[model samples]
Target: MGQPPLEAEIEIAATPDEVWAAISNVAAMKKRSPELVVMRTFGKPKVGRRSVNINRRKGFAWPTTARITRWKPPTNDGGNGSFAFYVWPTDVEWSYDLEPSSTGTRVVERRTALPDPSLSVRLTAKWALGGADNHDTELLAGMNATLAALKVEVEQP
Candidate 1:
């Protein structure tokens, strides 16, 4: 069987635009992610924008370059929208989608459409990052933590 997609979702007490603001800011992720140490973007979030994601675990830090592939702000009519980027080396796209809901706004984050890794990269992931299964577990856990932290931050007065 194929590997599972890494995903998580959360309902926030804010509007879609509010949630969008929080998630669109690359620098703000340091506050929302327990594993992310820093994210530096070369330009504002837009299609083709480039950024580097730096993550740490047990004192080991690694960086990955990414390019934005999709950037749709929340519509005024409360329609579905998404922000997404493709990370290099792994070639997986990470997306954050926004939608209106009864409670407030539903925010979904996912890592999907991962390209098959080359043998060397696969070995690196196994040794340094973790095996595929363990990495997916970590990604899912990180998504949940990120959404939960953003919910708390956005809900605060």
Candidate 2:
């Protein structure tokens, strides 16, 4: 509606599988995420698994539990490793994707199904922040930072 989805993509010097390892490991993610304060597993990490996500380090600090709505491991369709974590009833889908690239690999994050930028969106523009920026500015910056850090972490020999 407002925008198809909030997508941020960056190319990292690494392989697709290597990138997947970084995204798949919840423990590692918690440790590496600059803003991620805590991540606890409620069950196994699979298609039907669930986990609690606590985001901090910014002016905002909130904890939310999400279910693994999709667990896909690069099967055709661009063969980009993809997974979706749903916070439930919010219509928001936090998605991750990885694809091989000439430079090395490309990582993408799509925070889709966000509330269409409408009357309510304009009303809460100042108070609500979705993608790094309150109205989405430094989102790609953060995504790039994560991808760069991830590339460094994965490309180590």
Candidate 3:
């Protein structure tokens, strides 16, 4: 069995479009996400676009490739939107959902539950990533931090 899905949510004092601008810009995400060290995308980001990313924890770093699977911008009337990407090596999907909230926008960052991870991924998680469970716990914390940073960025004057 694979790890369970993980999520974190934060309300930002900005419109859904503003939030979407921040989340959709993969380059800026490297600054907000604690684990993301580098993000290089090929061509404009949209459904089917691909990116290469470098993530780090402690002193260990790893490379991951992902393809954009979902890219729905917020409606002009401040409706809901979401962005998602399917990652290789781990066979997981990461997404950000934006919904209009009373204050502004509710942003939810999530990692899909991995029901079946490859043998290589499992071994790498055990040997290099301090086991799947521990890394997942850290990933949850990172998600929280990432959202907090995004909130600050979007709300800044």
For each candidate in the order shown, give its overall lDDT on alpha carbons: 0.83, 0.67, 0.91
Tens-place lDDT digits, model 1, residues 14-99: 98988888888878989888778988989778999999888776656788889999999887445667899898777788899999
How far in Å is the alpha carbon of 42 misplaced in model 3?
0.3
- Give the range where candidate 2 is weakest over 10 consecutive residues by summed lDDT: 131-140
Candidate 1, which segments miss by more than 4 Å at Cα? none
* Among all candidates shown, the one with the greatest lDDT: 3
Residue 59's lDDT in candidate 1:
58
Write one digit per residue (lDDT tens) for candidate 2, span 22-109: 7777767665556667777676677778888777645866676788877777644555888778764334777788888898778887
What is candidate 3's lDDT per residue for 1-157, written digit by digit as tens? 6899999999999999988888888899899988999989899999999999999988888999999999999984457989999999888999999999999999999999987788988887889889999999999999999999999999998
Q: Which candidate comes out best when scored by TM-score? A: 3
What's each prediction's TM-score? 0.91, 0.74, 0.95
lDDT of 1 at 76: 44
Quote the lDDT for 113 in model 3. 94
Candidate 2 lands at a TM-score of 0.74
C-alpha lDDT of residue 116 in model 3 = 73
Give the TM-score (vs. native) of candidate 3: 0.95
